[model samples]
Target chain A: MIGIIAMRDLRSLFAQPLAWVVLAVVQGLVAWFFFSGVGRFERLQPQLSRMSDPPGITDITVIPTLDSAAIVLLMIVPILAMRLIAEERRAETIRLMYSAPVSMSEIALGKFFGLAGFLLIVVALTAVMPLSLLLGTSLDLGRLAAGLIGLTLLLAAFGSAGLFFSTLTRSPIVAGVATFGLLLFLWVINFGGVDLGPLQPAIDYLSMLDHYNAFLEGTIGTEHAIYFALVTLGFLTLSVQRLDAHRLQT
Target chain B: MEERSTLIEADGLQRFFGPTQAVQDFSFQLERGEILGFLGVNGAGKTTTMEMLTGNLAPSGGRIELNGCDLLDNPRPAKASVGYLPETLPLYTTMTVDAYLRFCARLNRVPKADLDEAVATAMRRCGLEDVAERVIANLSRGYKQRVGLAQAIVHDPEVLILDEPTKGLDPIQVREIRQLIRELGKSHSVILSSHVLPEVEAICTRVQIIHEGRLVLAEDVSALRARMQHSSLLLGGRALPAPESVQGIQGVERVERLDDGRLRVFHDTQSDTAEQIVARAASEGWGLWELTPERKSLEQVFVDLTGASESEVQDTNEEMAA
Candidate 1:
């Protein structure tokens, strides 16, 4: 049932021009950043050759490019995921799912996976930029894989949050703005708690960018993976609960 | 025997939207091969009751069984047997008609092997085969409604709940859709809601009238037709006796004289008022020319039960007659 709904959602997303526009714009920006990083690496190579130990091309170019890709995803995901449930409600098509035999969890998870699936395509397309460097120089395959994994998990978490916000309203514009606001707050939450000695660690643990950065640095810790998993699962569950409540409130 | 034939049973259903009570103590039983019509004016809880029966909304307190499966306790099997088309047609406008029906089939758990055939059959039944490849957004309103209906029956559910299916259509389109619904009624139990009394009278075997969130009347269409046999007679004649003299007849309760030299007499339902009036006209040299019994249309009955203005009912009756 979940797969059926997910496929339907994914197909509908591509049927619109918004998804294609987002893909083209994001890929254009990523490619520009990738070439700039390569230009900076070439300029520093002669100075690095004189040193006994120096930063490699992966650190100088690839990590920064992937880091920018994460930020780009953060801005564009809400645009893609906002219509998942909110548009259905606005159009009154949500009644179709409600009247069907599917469960609330199936609908919520289906929407989450559908949005994540689209974002995965964006991440995969970004990976090609780094892989192209294999034609000239040796690339750090381990760090590249870790960066891609981090981006995929980050997209999943973002998609779940967007899906939950979408379920809260019948207006797609409102859902998009709310999702973007909440994600921005979570990204900057680490800075807000830096002065509090006792609360700093707990607050820092909630920062999505911190966990994502650890992956970019090639340190794939269990805590980082768990944090992403918890966020993804937590929002998806809340979305299901919200949908179940609709049957009573309506 | 009654239990076996009962396909849908909703008992003591009540729903409250916060402080306002939307529906109260609404109960009805639908038997197999029955097309039940829900008739009500706007804000009469017809849509609310339909939503509850379709399992889209949970009633505050009630029990609903579809095909003998408890809707609240075990919804999947119950919902699987039912198909619903809400007041607003739920269409994924971006998808082609064929694709949307296919998706609905899968959502209803139609097996993969049977998906194509199910979609094809639904399209054919709704007359959507001609425009199956067109995006739903491009279809006309009547065609969009057909697509909505096609999706509802795509999985071949045993029960179909449609809310105002023919709403906002031209006369020709309405006729076509009504014909389609009547054809579907042969194989599936249907619950159709409409404010148009004639539509219900034309299609439903049983009719329910709801007013102010309460069911004011429930009767088989045949029984209701029997009630439509009004106990009033229109008597026209030259040199007729005064209305007061006509009122003195044994079965007559009241009499009103029309400007056209005709008298309308209200009488007891079981009495032979017509025979008595005929006897008086012959013996008294009344020269009776016309004596016809007035048959009340369903519109009059609905208006009388709902307490709507008598003038409005007359206007609609005149329009319908024309």
Candidate 2:
């Protein structure tokens, strides 16, 4: 069933002009960040290398600079995920989905994975960031691998969050706004001093930013990885329920 | 001698929206190889009924059974045998006609090995061969309608639910779609909803008329026609005797002239004795035209039986959707 849905999404994306535009814009941004990060790292290395670093240059320049890839992913995710469910509902294609033999779970997972596939390209385009480090500073394979793992999980969460918001409205613009707004709210909510102190422990575990920090330090924390996975699964599960209920109600 | 093939049996189905009742106490049954025309005026709960039966919208009360499988209890299994073509067609505008049907085929769980063959057959059957590669957005309205038909039948389900299948077609297109429905009726149990009474009469075997969210009548199309009090007359060739003179006949109650120049003479007594007038016309050399009994159009039958033609929610919805 998931294969059927993926096949449908893949064909739809390939055929739509809007999908092509989204793909091109995401790839352009990722490419721009890759070269710009490498250029900035090159210019900074000469001044910083002379001073004794707290950690090796691999930790200082490579891991930290490559973290820009995650930022690039953040910008690309909501755009790709915005159209997944919103457009389906707007176009009445959700009716077709509801009437199909496939379950709501299969539909959600297929769309999640399909959006992830497009987002993966944005993630993959940032390969130049790590490869550039290899050409100059010696690469830290462990940290880079850890960072990649973390980025994949983060992508899932972002995609799932976008998917859930997409379900909330029929307009892609609304889905995009809601997704980015939710993420921003999550980021800013922790800043309140009263809420931060009391909720800091739970906040850290729930925070996507903190979960991603583990990979930047060349560490693989199963707990952190699970946190991102849980967020992804949580939002996606909510999305499935929302859609199923909506289907049953109307 | 034959299988008791009950494709769909819906009973006491109702849908409410906030303060207003959309569909109330709706019920009907469709048997295999039976083409059932579902009739209602705008907002008479036609789409709502289709939605409930096809598993898109849940019923607020009552039950829908497909081949005896409870729709509310297990919608997927019940839906597996049903194909719904919504009034709007539910097409994916970005995909080509063929591609969309192939996608629908997969979604409907058609076997992988026969997917291509099945898609091809559905497209061909729906008269969508020439525009297979064109994006649905680019197709003409008539072609778009055919594509809707293709998608609905792509998986070859046993029960086909079509809502206003010919809502926006010219006369020729309507005729063509009617022919297609007749062909599909040979194998599938079809429940087609339309506001046009004549369309129901043209192709359907049984009809269920809903008025004000309730079942008005569910009977064979011919039976409904028979129940209508007034019988129509079919006159042909040159015109006949004067209206007053025809009305002056012994059994003649009223005589009205047709737009076609033929006279429609109504009678209450000696129904078979209209031939006496024909004989009189012939003997007097009064240039007798053709005289034949008029079959009431389905619209007249519905107007008579339902007694709520313009007021049904489903019928009103049929208009709004149009």
Candidate 3:
């Protein structure tokens, strides 16, 4: 059932122009970031060769481009996920999901996987820009792989949270705004006042930036993986619960 | 323990939103090969009751059994046996008719091997084969309605629930949809809710009138007509007998003359007074152009059963007609 619904959602997503527009804009921005980083690295390479320890192209051009792709995805993914459930509810097609033999969990997870699949395609298209630098430079393949993993997990987390808010309302605009607000809050919560003693670590743990920063440096720690995994599961479960409650509350 | 032949049995179904009692004590039993028409005024909780039966809304208190399976306790099998077309047709406007039906078929757990055949059959049944490749958003309202019905029955459920299936349709489209529904009723137990009394009288085998969130009356259509059998004859002609002369006939209860050169003769309910009136008129050479027995329309029965006054019923019926 999840596979079936996921395929349907993906099909519907492509049927509309929003997905194509978002893809075009994100790729344009990613390509721009990649070329600028390459130009900066080219200028800095002559001076850095005299130093004892010189940063390679991966550290200067590829990592920053990957990081920029993550930032671009964070802003655009809510738009992709907004229509997953909210548009269905608004258009009254959500009743088909409610009355079908499939469970609420399957519906929620199907939508989550569907948007995640689209985001993965976007991530892969963006990765081609960084991977193309291998023609003239020795790129750190391991770090690039880690960053891709981290970005995909983060996209899944964002997709799940966006889906939760979508289930909460019938307006896709409201769902998009609410999801963007939640993701922004999670991203900036750790940058509050520096005087907190006990809550500092907890706030840092909740922040998405801290976990994603570790993958940018090629460190694949279980802690960050667990953080993304737990957050994804939490939002997915809440979405399922919200869907079940919708049947009851309506 | 009883061998239940009832396809759908909803008892004491109640749904309340905050302090408003949307529906209460609504109960009905739908058997196989039955086309039950649920009639109610707007905001009379007809849609709420249907949402409960279709598992879109949970009742505050009720027990619904579908084909011997408890709806609440065992929703999967119960839901699998039912197909629902909501008031606003649930459709993905971007999808083609064939794709949407296939999606609905898979969602309802139709096996992979049977998916194509199921979609084809549903399209053929709903007369949607001609525009199977058209995007749903581009289709006309009638075709959209047919697509809705096709998606609902793609899984071949045993029970089908339609909420105002023919609402907002033109005369010809309404006839087409009603014909499709009647054909579907032959194989599946159908529960249709509508505000149009004539449509109900035309298609439904049984009529269930609901008012103020309660089941006011439930009976076979023929039985309901029989209950309102007020042996009245409408005699129309240029030179009809006087009202008093018609009243003098045996078994005649009362007589009144209409403005349009017609005599309405009320007679004993147990007698064939209409036959006698026709014979008497024929023998008297009163220019009997027409002698038709008047069965109280479902509209009159609906108004009387709903406990609304004649004027209020007229207002709503006029609204419905417009």
Q: Compare the candidates by lDDT and give the number of the best one.
A: 1
Q: Write down the lDDT of every candidate, Cα atoms only.
A: 0.90, 0.78, 0.88
Tell me the tens digit of each residue's lDDT in model 3 across A46-119.
89999899988889998899888878888898888887888888888989978888888899989988888888
Local accuracy of candidate 3 as per-residue lDDT tens digits, B1-322:
4645699999899998878899998888999899999987887799999999989998999899888888888988888989999999999999999999999999999999999999999999999999999999999999999999998899999899999999888999999999999999998989999887778888999998888898899888888767777668888876786788888788998888887778888887877787787788788888778887787755577677776888887877766676
Candidate 3: stretches off by over 4 Å: B1-4, B240-242, B279-285
Interface RMSD of each: 1.0, 1.7, 1.1
Residue A49 error, candidate 1, Å: 2.0
Write model 1 residue lDDT over B131-191, tens digit each, in one string.
Answer: 9999999999999999989988998988999999999899999999999999999989999
Q: Write the per-residue lDDT of candidate 1 for residues A79-159, one digit (tens) a residue.
A: 888888999988889899998898999999888888878888899899999999999999999999998999898899999
RMSD of each: 3.5, 3.7, 2.3
Fnat for every candidate:
0.82, 0.69, 0.76
Local error of candidate 3 at residue B293 (angstroms): 3.7
Model 2, range A89-201, lDDT digits (tens) per residue? Answer: 88888888888766889989989888877667656655555666666557768877777777777888899999999988889998998898777665444555565566688
DockQ of every predicted complex: 0.74, 0.64, 0.74
> Considering DockQ, where higher is better, how would the candidates rank from best to worst?
3, 1, 2
Which consecutive 10 residues in model 2 chain B have the weakest lDDT in total?
B229-238
